[model samples]
Structure formats: structure tokens, C-alpha cells
Target: MKNSKEWYKLDAFAKTYSSIISEGRTTCFRLSVLLSEEIDTDLLKKTALFLEQKYPFYNSELKKGIFWNYLQHKRNGFSVELENTYPCTDVKRENPLKIIYFRKKISLEIAHFLTDGIGASDFFIDLIEKYLEMKYFKREVNEREVGNNEETNNLKYKYEMEKSSKNEKISEYSDLYSKYMKRVNKEKTVKHAFHIPLKILEKGQYYVTTGEISIEDIKRESRKYNTTVGKYLLAVYFKILLDKYPQIKKQIVIGVPVDLRKIFSEKTYRNFFINITPSIDPSLGSYTLEEIIKYVNNYFKIKITKKEFYKSIYKAINPMRNIFIKSVPYLIKRIFFPFIFDYYGERGYTTGVSNLGILKLNRKYSKYIKGFRFLPPPSKRCKIKMGIISDESKVYLSFGNLTANHEIEKEYFTYLRRRGIKSKISTNY
Candidate 1:
């Protein structure tokens, strides 16, 4: 163990989670930011230095697989095996941190294994804001929030805040629960990789808005309905799908990712999560909006819990002991993974949902960032991904993909509008 080079931040979740032979590629996103104020080069450098010191991973290596080890073992960023993974280190910090002066806007490309849009967005804003404040106001920054700030509510305080429902237990398993076990064992290579370019649209240009649902209102509605905020939105989409394509609702499957934080008390920096509990729309062909919402709610309730979450982790970790014992050659482990892991994500979900809850900008850049947006990776398998976020006052729903066809997505929005929830839809096709 002498040359182990163990750093506390070495993400065990990313390490262990990546061991499974599925979508070996990590989740990644790019952020483009425009500052309202002038940039401070010196302060920016100081900020990067502070981030490096504070989050030791900034100085690490990605030598081991994206999950195994990092290039700079203690660097403050994602782990990637450079030669193997294309666009591996999207957020290139090779140039001097002072390069902030040369660029008007910077794009931060990050792997999802490290942080979701909300998490990465939080860190990105914090780093820049802290740098500015340190240079101008000479104030210190505290990375981790404690005390009242420790409450998950304050996690994104600058935008808006609302209280979550008290924990509630279900008496019976939901009716929507399916009898089949969901696993990604099949692989199919897509003829063309799905790539969608982000289009920067003028705010409030694309859609008309009517009634607005506030953050408090959404949370309250979710609790009142005995469902989750995510499920509430899904309920909205399900109704949309049912109404728009009334003849096509034969057991439609909608997928939502379950954040493990709700189940585990442990804190780690990695993409360790699970998809929504799968259930068929038994009455899809004949169900009404209210019925669909209720079904989605009940199903979401049964699938998520500390017990089930742990069970998922357990199953993922100790895979095929009987077969793995034969020990595929090391060369096979390296070569066979890409084909196997990718096949897993394809067969894993009929559709995908990534809900990065309310995104509130830090106080430091409160004047700089007007609103936030998140678009997930669009693939042929999961042609559409719904990203939902709340700005304390209103919730934003968006449909993302590389395909230019607007009929499907437009239908989705039209359905939402019909449901009394007002929203703006933007597309970068």
C-alpha cells in the first residue's frame, strides 16, 4: 500500500459504480457563462488557487479509468483515461488560470460522474464569485455550509427557497410497479452518435406563458398529492403524451433518475444514482390526466427507499461472481467494456429524465447570472430528455435532443399548457 497514492476525495462511488459493464462513458455537460461585470485576472487566479487547495481533486490525475484514478492524482477535477476517452478532459485547465482575461466567456465541460448540472453549476458560480469578492471586498469564503445552511433547502439559496415535505411512508406497494427486473445487458452500437448543439435563445422569445407555479406551490402540490416534485412533472408529461397521442399510450414507460442522496447518509462526489422504478401505463390507451398522475405518483413511491437504493448498489457491485471468477483477461476488461457498458445504457431505459432541482445563483453573482439552463445528452435510444428546474418563482421545463423535428416536443409543451401549468420551451435543433 506504500505507493497506493490514496487521497480522501478519490470517489469510491465513481470507482465502484464504473466497475459495472455498462455505458462506460461518464455523464458530461458544458456551461457557457457571461459575466455582467468586468473580470479580475488576479482575483481569478487567486480563486483557482483557492479551489485547488480547497477541493484537492482539482490537482489530480485521470490516469485510471474515468472512475478508477485521476491524471493528477490529487487534482481538483474529474478522473479520465486521456488516451482512451475522447474529449476526455473537456474542461481543459492546461493554460494558465489567468487566461480568464483572454476569453470573454468560458465554457466548462464536466463529466456527470462528478456532479450533476446543479452540483457543477453551484461549484462553478461559487469559484468565480469567491474570486471576485476576494479581490474587491477582501472577504473569505466557506466551502461547506453548516448549521441552518446545512439544511438542503439552503443548498441553492440565492434564487428561491422552499421547504420539502416531511418524510412519509407508504402502506402498500404502488399499482404501477412492474413485475420484470430492469437491467442493461443488451448492446447495440448506434450508427451515428447523437450530438445536439446548444442554441442560445433570447429569453422569453419562443413560448407564451400564462399561469405561473411558484416553487412553494410546486412543492406543496407534490406533498399534497403524495408524490415527488419529479413525479409531479412526469405526471404532467404523461398527461401531455396521453392527450396529444391518445391512440398511442400502450404501456408507455417514462424514466426518472433517483438521486441516492435521499437514501444514503454518506456524502461523496460521484455519479452514483439509479433510474425511476419502471411501470407500464396499463390504462395508457384509456387513462385520463388525473389517473396518469396518480399512477406515476404511486409508482415513484414504491420504487424509491433506503432499502431499495441499497439493494441496487449491492447488485451493481457484486456482478456475475460465478462468471467474473473465471476472470476475463485484463486485455478483455479494457477492450470489452466500451461495447458492453454502452449497450447497457441503450437497453436500460425507454426514455430518460434528469431533474436537477431548483438552481439558485450564489449571492456574489446574483446580478450577473439572470437564469440557468441545463440540457442533457440526447441519444437515439433516449431520443428525448426532459430537464426541469425552478427559479423559486417559476418552474422551467425543456425538451432536448439532436433531432430537429418539433412536432413531438411541441406536442409535449402544448399538453403542459393545457394542464394549467405555464412554461417557456426553447430548442437548439
Candidate 2:
């Protein structure tokens, strides 16, 4: 173990936010793939050794009670433990990677902070394919993407300006509203135990007429409905819910995570992002898909302007208890977060839909890979959570937190397939 050194300031902020909000148990996403070969235990060790050697940052620990501090400079990194814990420092004496290669299912759970929806897609796809090749092809394969260099110079604003915008104040969360905050504070946050099963997802080459769809296509379609692609997708999902859960009348709000980089010019490799801008909750018996699209599109178009972007950033960064909580220690932040949540209402959204838009990667895996799909973290709020991620060729629709909703997932794939597009659904369902 090493003594704590000062971490980048932004990293500290990210650590603060995540520690406060992350419940630990449901924060990670579990991915299951069926394997064809017998367990390659030695090769699994080799792969872990290869990763550690290739990316030294994977061995580092969090300091100042902040995970982001450990990751600020390392854009791509992960720490392997014999087990999981916050501020994990110990290194694995044995190979952390495991393989079942059973007739059933193989699986892996990924920490959300390690990668976003887009990044996870590449990693998962690459990992599966690499494992396959190692067993069958007997050849080493590299699927890592390169050159995610910061482009602050090309942006219009400075990081400080963005920081200032992020520091603005917003209306506080009412204690009456943030009831879950207390449970979160005193609750024993469950850290999920490791489980990589042998479930498999079938793969195939998919092509679409809209594979060549450019920004112009997105913009044109958006205008056709007077909405962004995000709003359009929200409308589609909302319709699916209506079709499935016709009896439920609660507000159907979809959480949309807005990337601050779209507005700010900060290039720091930390999670300085916020999930704001919910779609208009469709009325119980009244709203049609087109109507929901209109309402959501108009609302997003109005709310996500430069002014709203900065305002939302400010609300997330500038703590309501800043002056008072300032006297509170960093360690206390993790313990007493429910007090804050009780005030803030746990980010007023029901389901999450993050659009990393299109995934961009280097020449690696270009020839072998067809596309990508983003599966959102399973929600305690909703039974079925959906996300869409695309490459140049196809739109991959994925659902998470769904224990056995393959029928519903199949319906979505069928809907897209009927639209004259190439599609596939991947899940244990």
C-alpha cells in the first residue's frame, strides 16, 4: 500500500458525487455469454497478466476516499480484487479472471464507473471474441481502440468556464420528496459477489439500409418529428411500455444522461457528467407515440439549450449544503448522503436511456466486428430497461434488469426488423 497523494481536483469531485449516489449493489452491470469450449483456466490467467502488463493503471488504488481520483488521468483502467470493495487497494495474488465454459451460460459483472455504455460494448464484444479465438483460433487478437485524445482546443469554451457553469445553484430537493435518502444513508449497501455464468448470445452479420445514415439523416429525421434522435427513441420505448404494461398509470419518465462535454471543453478523464433531462411522462390513457414524441422533442429542444445545459451542470456540482457540509469530512460524505438525497429527490427520473450516440473506435477489430449495443444498468425502479448503441452498420437494441422478458425484447427486435432494418436482441431474457 502507498501513502495518499493529492489527486486531480475534478477527480475528487467525481468521487464525491459517485460515493454519495452509488448504492454499490445495483450500480454494476452483469453480462452473460454462453461459451463453447472447456474452461481455459490457464489462458484466463494469461489474459489477466496481459491486461495488467499492458495497462499499469489497473493496479492503482483510490485515494482521498475517491474512485475518480484513481481514474482521473487513466482514461481506461480497472482494478481487480480477490473481492470487491470501495477504495480497493489490494492486488490479486491469484488470477482474478474466471471461466465456467459450461453448457449453460458464462457471465461477468462490470463496474459502471470503469466504462460507459459505449465503452462497455466494445470491451464485452472484444472479450468474447478474444476468448473464442484463444480457444479455437490459437491466435492472439487485439481489439482495443486507440486515440481518444482530448480536443479541448476545438471547443468554444474553457474548462474553468464549464466548471463555473457546473457550480450554479438550483432548487433544492424537498425532504418529503427524497424519502429514499435516509434508507440509502443507513442501509448496508450490498456489493455484488462475482458471478460469470456460461450463458451465450448468438452472433451474426447484420446490415441495414440506414447503415450509411449520417448526422444529416439524424437531423432530418429529428426535424421530421421536431425532435432529437434521443427523444425519438424515448417515444418508441414509451410506446413499448404502453403496449406491455397497459394497466399501470404511473408517470412514465425516462432518465436521459446529458454529457457535459457536448457543451463544456474540459478534457479531464473523470466522470464529470450529469443525468438530467427526463422525457415528458406520458399521460395514462391519452398519449400516443407520435404525441409523446412531439412533447418530448419540444421539451428537450427547449430544455437542452446552452443556458439549460449550464444550469443543470451547476445544480449537480454546487452542493446545497456546501458551506455547512464543508466542515464535514470526505469520509462522512459517503455515510450521510441520504441527508442530501432527501433534499434532492434522487434525481427525478424513472428509467435511464444514455445515448453515447455512435461509438467511435480505431482500426482495430474493424474487419471482424459488425456493430455495438449498449445495455443500461438494471434499474431498481423499472423491470425492463432499454438502451440503443449503433456503429456504421446497425442499431443494436438491448435490455437489462429484465429477468425473463425475452418475449418483450423479442417484440422490440421484431418491431425494428419489420422496419426494414437489421437488428438483433442479446440477453438471458
Candidate 3:
């Protein structure tokens, strides 16, 4: 196959995010696979090289242009390397994405500009499938299931862009803008939510702690609460926060990223998700777990409707559509956008929780795979974030923290244990 020298423009979401990224502060997401055995560096390298040929988009490098940043196909071949530092600390023009393997773990760290978790997971699954085949069977996996060429590879992007651009309704846009304005007008100026007090670590340093619990037990608890797993978990997160910081009597808002692939029919490996922040105000009164679950369930029901979801998307994209905003020079937009994001964007939400849903693998490859963990990007304001991934039997809750405190994590596991769920903890310090 010949390499095409084609450049793809960043989508609206990516375009907005690319401007705000700085050194040590990035919009990178990590999807890691923990193998049952030690990694074969040579074989893993060969696997990455082969997969890069199949998905050339992963091989693209970021470039700064007159109007916006774009991705151009990398002329030189791609290679996998050993991981040296924490996740997503060095995403820039030199290397926007990377594949790193350390001992039993193989991680794919991609800049958020490239794709969302759904898209990245698709690519990672194919890479793992191909790797297993090459390692054990010594054969090439069939491409018919995935696609033939690069164009077919990015079909999701093509479909989503086409659909998003075509369905422009002025009324819908106005309604979304109105809602955003109403929220901002009455938005309370609250201090950053209390985090477990600990000595701050050096820049780019992160502490990762993971807890494994039985999926069956999680389901049982969720059923008892009459809510979905995601909501139940969010309730638990809020409960722990309240326990740790009882003195603060303000609302605690947690950002939950909803995957748009299910709602929108697009299958693109690019980003297509929106964040919804569900909040609980302790000033109202002490909230029982039942009340928190009820609030979370109602929030999800209202916000996840197609009309509401589309409104949120339009709200996000509406700024880019303005003629005046679009007319601003790139340099000014670069400086102004990050400030807007820092003050209005990051401050609104206390923390973020992303549930990647369950991972399905063929039985043959399942034995070689132990499980999966997701590491969220580091944030200065929101010091701790939670990422959830599950296999058939066990659910993995990973906490990616910028602070050195273990108090919050300790309370979380203890709460779970009190509910008759035992947890096994592991950490990368």
C-alpha cells in the first residue's frame, strides 16, 4: 500500500481543545491493557509497526498552520518505545501520540485532538487482537472486519462531520445559548471543592491507585439503590467527598463524560462526547445515599435525552460558528481561549468520572489479557479524577491524582468494604 500525503482538519471539538494545551498540561487520554505475562518488546514493536500501516491516521503528526492546527501524515515510520514518565505529560508537535509498553502493561496514549475514548478503544482493541495473533498464531489477522484503506478507516469522522454540519437549526442553537447564559448568570462563585490535603507533587508527576471489585457485587448494590452502575458509583464518590470534607457546605459538581457513539450513529475514531456535571448542594441538607442516587438518576434521564444532548452539542459548537470569533487571529484566539477554559471551563466542575463500559474480547485472547485500566489527564484545579473499566467478572476503578494524599482513596475503599464488597488495591508510585 502507498502512503497518501493527505492532511485532515481537526473537528470542532478538537480545534477548541488544541489551542489550550500546554507543556505538562495536556488533553491526552490513556487506554492501557495489562497482559498476564511480561511484554516482548521486540514483538510489541513489530506489532505497532504493522498496525500503523493499517491505521495510518494514528501515525499522523500535529502541525501548526495559519488558521488552525492540522494533522499531516508522518513521512517517517512509527515505532513503540518504553514508557519513561507518567501518562500524557508530553503531548506536542514532536509526537502527538505514542504507544508505550512497560513490563505487563501496553498503553496507547493519544492526544484528545485525535479521538475520544470510544475511538481510541476501537483502535487499541484491533492492535491487541493483531498482537495476539502475531505472538501466538504467527499469522496476519483479516482486515475485512475493520476496513480496507485509510478512507474507510475514518468513515466515522466523515459521517459525523457531515451530519453535524447539515442539521443546523437556529432555534435549537438559540435555546442552547439561552440555557448556557441562564446557568452562568446565577452560577455561584464557590471555592474549588475540598481535596484530601497532601503535599503537592512536582509538575508532571501523578499517583495512580486502582481497586478491583467483583462486578456481581457492584450490580447487586446498584440494584439495591434502584439506579444504574454509573450513578451508583457517582453517589459513592460524592458520599466519600462529603465524609472527607464535612466542613464545606457548598455544592459538589462532578463531570461525567457521555459517549456520543450510541446516541449519534457515527462510528468515527474522532471525539464525539459531551460532559454533564451533576451536582449536590450540601447547604440544602445532609444527603442520604438514596437521595443522591435519585438526583443522579433524574439528572441522567433529563440530560441524556436526544433533544438535550443535541442542545449541549450545539451549545459547545455555537461559539465557533460566530463570525466575529472565527474572525479573530489565531494568536489572539490561542491566548484568549485558554483563559476562558481555565476560569469558566475547569472551575465549574469539581472532578470528572468516565466509565468506559465493559470490554468484550474473544475467549481465545481473553486468557492472555488480565484486565484494563483508564488513566485520566492531570488537572491543576481538579486534582483527582476517576476512571472505570470492567471485564466479565471484575470492575476496575482507577484514581489518577496530582496530589500525594491517599486519604480519599482510603475512604472510598473502606466505604465499599462496609457495603460487603471487598477490594484489592494496587498502585504505581
Candidate 4:
């Protein structure tokens, strides 16, 4: 109800998204959690409202400034929707973020401007926690508070207590991408990678195919190669692509997003990860899975270093920090930025795979939760975007596709199945 919120510019990672967002190319992602039973819609609605106060950035809207763009906050109310369409569709600028609940799941479909997968999960987890607290734990405490005139106070106390646990740095709105940015020598450019030429799905359609497999299985397989699970998976991914396009000469580049928070003591949730392109150049000749893994791991080892990583991060942070780029009026920047982004950004990679790592839920709330899934947003050039999240037992691999074909996803899982990693596939076809 108040406009006391301060003004801020869009984070560096959001510049491309902001420009292309208007062309109906809003880069978006979905974080979903399943519950033990059907969701209590009424209570989930209240939980969404409460979580908003805790994460006010979700309510932000983009406004064009003369030189750049400004993100203005408006405490506009949002209503949860029933899950009907495929997950991770393009969210319009007007309603850049939304919460939709299915029977046993609540999915947050948010624009890239909102936050990264990790940031989204923070809010999604809180929403689930608050809802469960109200449904079970708070009810457990309700009998105590009902005996006095402190009912309202008790509720507010719970709100404040939970809210207080969160680090206040979340509200600071500092651009972590820019904050940790280091100037580097000539920023290297990415050449065009092998693009999946699958038939595009109908305009209103998006395909999400999930493969649920045991984390232990993945670990066992990965260790056999002396590589981590992510690198191992990329090896298999490259192998699959190489097999499918045996004759293609281009590199099979996948955008593997790195969490800068690991090195930089940053807390802003706006958007702060950089994609490291780990690729397989088919021209190098045929290679086995182990060879592919070795190649992928080598790329990863080199990229993680401070010098190598900043070179990549500098490319993204430079535009936002560049005086010329910032001074070129939003109108002109918007016109050329999208073209540059699609050509330079997404064009650099064939597809993207982001691993959000394992999620360990609180014991108190574990019974109320089922599992979690991460769906990465697809790009114009990259037909399929993938995400991986693991709970204690299983790893969930979701492919958000724009194509009618399931060949790539099917083959990826098929490779895992051959390795004795059984995968139960599900899709929103």
C-alpha cells in the first residue's frame, strides 16, 4: 500500500532478459515442490502473501530509465493459479512471477528478473514451511495461543521470528554480479555451438520431461570415471548429442551455470550466476564416455579458477558497468541488446544444464514435503534447457523443451539406464 521502496537498476544478468522480455522471450524458470497430500489451497494462498513480505523482490516490475532500466517495487497483490499448462512457459512482463498449485505441488513460475534457481528455492521453501507450520505446527501451537487475547500478537510473533531468521542482506539489492566482477584482459567470445534442430512445439506448448533416478546410482557411476556427478552427466550429454548428430562438425556446447556465491561472499538473490560453456568439438574425432568426461572435467577445472571464471563473468558484468553501454539510452539499447544477446549469449551454447545440488529439508517439515524439481528456461537457439535437483534418495532431472521430439531426453536417460541407473520418466506432454 506504500511506495516507500527505493529504486534500483536491473542486475547485469537481467539486461538481456529485460530487453528480450518485451519480445515475448522472457527467460523464466520454475521451482516446484511436491507435498505428501493435496495442497490446502486457502492456506497456501495466505502463505504466498506472507512469503511476499519476506521476499519483496518478487513484486518488482521493470521500468525504462533514460540510460538503463529501473526496477520499481509495487506491493501489488497476486492470486495463486491452478496448474494446467506445461511448466516453465514464458511469463509476460505484466505478471513476471506467479505461484500455481496442483494437487500435491506448488510451483513458482518466475521470470529471470526475479531471481536464480537458488533464490527462487529460498522463497518456495519458505512458502512450504509457512504453509505446513500453519497446517500442522502452528495448529500444534494454536491451542496454546487461543486461551488469551494474544492471538494476533502470537501470529505476528511467529511471522517476525521466521522473518528475522533470514539474513537482512537479502533486502540490500546490491548487484552481486557487478560487485564481484573483476576486470579481465580481452573478454573471449563464444563461437556458435551445435544447435538441436528438433521440430518446435506449437506456440502455446512447452514440454517438461522429468527423469527420476537414485542419487546413489548417479554417484556410483560418476565415481567410476573419477569425476563428479555434474561432469559425468555432461559427458553423457555430450556423448548423446554426438551420437545423434554423428556427422555434425560443430561443438556440442552446454551452458553449465556456476554459483559465484561459492567464492564471493554475496547474498543478493536478484540474478548472479554465470554459465560456463563446457563443450565437445566433434571435429576432434570420436571419443568414449570416459574421454568425454575427461574433456568436460578438464574444462570445469580450468574454468573454476579465479582468472578463468572472471573472464566469463566480466563479459556479462561489463555491459552493465560500461559507461557507453549504460549511456546509450534505453530505447537504443533495447533495440540492439536483444539481437546481441540472442546472437552472443544463447548462441554460444547448444543447451544449458544447471544443477541446484541436493536439498535437505528440515526434519520437522520433511513429512509434509514430497520432493523438488528444477526446470530451466529454454532459449530460442537452445531448444532444450535442463535442471537437476536431488533430495536424500533420488535425483530429479527435468528437461524443459520447445520441441515435439523426445529423442534427446529419451537417449540421455537410455544411456543412464544402460549404466544400471534406473530412471522413471514423467512428462507434461
Best-matching candidate per lDDT: 4
Q: Candidate 2, 122: how far from true, in Å?
A: 9.7
Top TM-score prediction, candidate number: 4
Clashing pairs in 4: none
lDDT of 4 by residue, 89-133 (tens): 657665778889988888888888767877777777777777888
For each candidate, the alpha-carbon lDDT, in order, equals 0.45, 0.42, 0.74, 0.76
Candidate 2's error at 113, in angstroms? Answer: 4.6
For 41-66, candidate 2 gives per-residue lDDT tens digits of 55544454444323222223334432
Best-to-worst order by lDDT is: 4, 3, 1, 2
> How do the residues 359-425 of candidate 3 rate in per-residue lDDT, one tens digit apiece?
7777789889988988777776677889898889999999988888878888898998999888889
Q: Residue-wise lDDT of candidate 1 within 251-366, one digit each (tens)?
A: 45565766664564433233445665354443425666567678776766776775555455544443423366225543455555545544644455545667777666656555
Estimate the TM-score of every prediction: 0.63, 0.58, 0.86, 0.90
Segments in model 1 whose C-alpha atoms lie over 4 Å from true places: 1-26, 30-45, 64-108, 115-122, 128-228, 242-251, 282-284, 320-326, 329-331, 360-365, 425-429
Please give the distance, in angstroms, between residue 118's alpha carbon in candidate 2 and its true position after superposition. Answer: 6.5
Query: Hey, what RMSD does candidate 3 come out at?
Result: 5.3
The true-versus-predicted C-alpha distance at residue 132 of model 3, in Å, is: 0.8
Q: Which pairs clash in the backbone of model 3?
A: 156-268
